[model samples]
Target: TQLLEQSPQFLSIQEGENLTVYCNSSSVFSSLQWYRQEPGEGPVLLVTVVTGGEVKKLKRLTFQFGDARKDSSLHITAAQPGDTGLYLCAGARDKLVFGAGTILRVKS
Candidate 1:
C-alpha cells in the first residue's frame, strides 16, 4: 500500500499571511490531487496534477507536483479568514491514498 504524508498538521495565521503545506510519499503516483474541506462538508477538489513538475494556480492558491511525482505542495498567498479549513492531498494509481491533512485557521 502507498502512503502520503502531510506536514504541519495544523496552521494558524493572520489574514494576509502566506503559508505552504506539503505532502510526500515514498511511492510515485500516477496523479496527485488537492482538496479542501469545510466544517460538516465533504472535501472539495482544488486541483489535480498528472504530470511531474506541473504547477497550477487557482486564485490565491498554487499547487505544485514534484519532478518525481512523489511529493506535492499547496501554497496560499495572502490567505484570508475565509480560507480556514482542512486541506488534504491524495495520490492515485489503482486506488487513492490520502494524507492525514493540514488544518488551517486564518484569523482576522
Candidate 2:
C-alpha cells in the first residue's frame, strides 16, 4: 500500500514568521507535488520535483524532495496573512496520494 503522511496538520503563525511542513512515506515515488488551497478554491500546484535530492523555490517558499523520493518538505521563509491557507503534499506513483493537509493561519 502507498500512503503519504504530513505532520503538523495545523499551524498558526504571525505575519512574517517562518514555518516548515514535512511529508513522509514508506513507499518510493517517481515524483512528488505540492499544492496550496484556499477556502472555496481548488488547490493550486506549487511545485513538482521528479529527481531525488532536487529542490525548488518560489518567492519565499522552498520545496525539497527526499533523496529516496519517499518524502518532501515545504519551508516558508516569511509567511504573510495572504499565505493563510491549507497546504498539501502529494506522492506520485501510478496515482497521486494526497496528505490530509496542513491548515496554516498567518495572523496579522
TM-score winner = 1
Go through the candidates in order and give each one's C-alpha lDDT: 0.96, 0.92
What would the per-residue lDDT of candidate 1 be over residues 18-99, giving only the tens digit for each residue?
A: 9999999999999999999999999999999999999999999999999999999999999999999999999997999899
Model 2, position 71: C-alpha lDDT score: 95
Which tens-of-lDDT digit does each residue in 1-108 have in candidate 2? Answer: 328889789999899889999999999998999999999999999999899999999999999999999999999998989989999998888888899999999999
How close is every model to the real structure, measured as TM-score? Answer: 0.97, 0.96
Which candidate comes out best when scored by lDDT? 1
Clashing pairs in 1: none
Name model 2 segments beyond 4 Å from true: none
**Which residues of candidate 1, in runs, are more than 4 Å off?**
none
